[model samples]
Target: MPVRFGRIAARMFLPKKHNPRLAVLLMIVATAFIAATTLFAKALGGDTLGPPLHPFQISHGRFVFAFIAIASAVAATRPQLTRPHWGLHFARTFFGWGGVTLMFASVAFIPLADATAIVFLNPVFGMILAIPLLGEKVGRIRWSAAAIALTGALLLLRPTPESFQIASLLALAAAMIMGVEIIFIKKLSGREAPIQVLLINNFLGVLIASVAVLAVWQMPTAAQWAVLIALGICMALAQACFVNAMARADASFVAPFSYGTLIFATLYDIAFFAQIPDWITLTGAGIILSGGLLLAWREARLRQLP
Candidate 1:
């Protein structure tokens, strides 16, 4: 039974051939699950308790549950926990932990749709960051697309003197850090197993979130438990899909589909929180998605050229 389970689990996380279509499909599914996780984070932050739960504590619960949930798969499937590339794994953990922390913190106070839209800025950053960090070249069209995408994010943020929001800045920072994180993941993806990649990040998140939560920890209610469970299971499965998607397709191709997260997130926001996006928000999101798609198409064409 154990062997069979292990094989089944291992098969799910293992990388497959380059299939842009399959990668897009997996990314679509991942976006939905990730949107739900964001909603749960919002719920936890604004629960009935006199003081809302700390974002760090919520982050802790998220990874702790995810780590526990993935344990069965790891025990049954992976031959080893630690890999040869310890340095890369630790670096990934550092960047991933920072990104996740900021992401959760953003959702706790911002509208889900707004937060989701801004995080899609990673592709723009990824394209630009690649030149320096990964020593990759970017053509003029991609550069134009990056500029358009940045403009779109600014449109979505639309900071006003009277209505400035720190959450928006946090989301942008999360996207920037995650852009670097994605590049690092690409560096390691071909060399490391996807499951172990996820495990390393989640384990580190559990450790970091645990220590940070100690300053503002509170007991979880039953409802909060359900939210955390959903966060854990959904994020674990979502991360698997995302990692595999990137491994199988160009990051640009896989990236634009992430804007689909905005759609799902907006729906979740409306359905759960009764928050509807104003015309400006919808307009900005549309521009953002267009820019992201443009970047993806340009990157894909570049890859096909040589």
Candidate 2:
């Protein structure tokens, strides 16, 4: 049993052919890493160092460091920073920065799993936004899938008559902005390098967040500094893995598997915060995953029909 399990684990982790199975596995692992990192960030945010920076501040710092690290690495490897299209670069800058800011803000108020789940709605919003933004056709299947996914989101939110937390809305807005970011990235494909886009997005995020960090800048304790650095490194690695996985396969094939983050987030929440999601949250998550799978299948079928 041990040997068999080892072999299975090796197959899941090892880099090999870029088949659909491998792509799905990579995406799942990437999502798990991201979810775990989110929990780690939350834990670190509770630290008393640096005057208790908001999640947005921590996220901003992470991106600033990430930009420097990625830029240095790109310069060391590629030695070129020229972009073919400035408009696409600018679009990525705006969308990516705004999305990250809003996502971080939501994290400050919501549970790890809830925040992650809400952000996963990006694909659902992507389909809706694509019709108007990219002049793409949204067929009946896509429309239905979007509606089901949105319904799942509403169930998870379960807005009360008197309860109002703008953070929830911020998360939804971030997801929508992320959908737009993904569309723009698709537009930039073949015209710009992935590393270039990452650099531009991070650079802009840092510039935008610098003001906040300045206003709220407090010296972090040794432990807080360590966790901050670690979070930045994990984020960079996750982004690298995600980029490699996407490059190896079709987005439609890999995106659904990214939902595996929910599993990791739930585990981390349970282990770290002693939090267990209720049945409603679990049911809503299931519906969201189902909708995503349906959309992926539809896309795959459409790809094959041609």
Pairs of residues at least 3 apart in sequence or in different chains that clash in candidate 2: none
Candidate 2 global lDDT: 0.71
- Which ranges of candidate 2 are over 4 A from the true structure? 1-22, 47-51, 79-82, 161-166
For model 2, residues 1-306, the per-residue Cα lDDT tens digits are 333332332232223466776666667778876886677567656644444567666777678766666665565455355645767767876787678767767766667777777788888787777788889887899878877877777877768866445677877888899988888877887775666666677777777667657776777778777777666656665666677678668877787677888899888888978789878678777777778778787877777875
Each candidate: what lDDT? 0.79, 0.71
Name model 1 segments beyond 4 Å from true: 1-11, 14-25, 49-51, 79-82, 243-255
Candidate 1, residue 256: how far the Cα is off, in Å: 3.5
lDDT of 1: 0.79
Model 2 TM-score?
Answer: 0.84
Clashing pairs in 1: none
Query: 1-306, model 1: which lDDT tens digit per residue?
Result: 434544555565765899999899999998998998888888888855334678887788888877865665687665565554766766777777777778889988889998888888877887788999889988788888877778877877777887677788988998898898878777886685667767777887788778888988877877787777778878877776787788788886587777788999999989988899988678877777888888889877776886
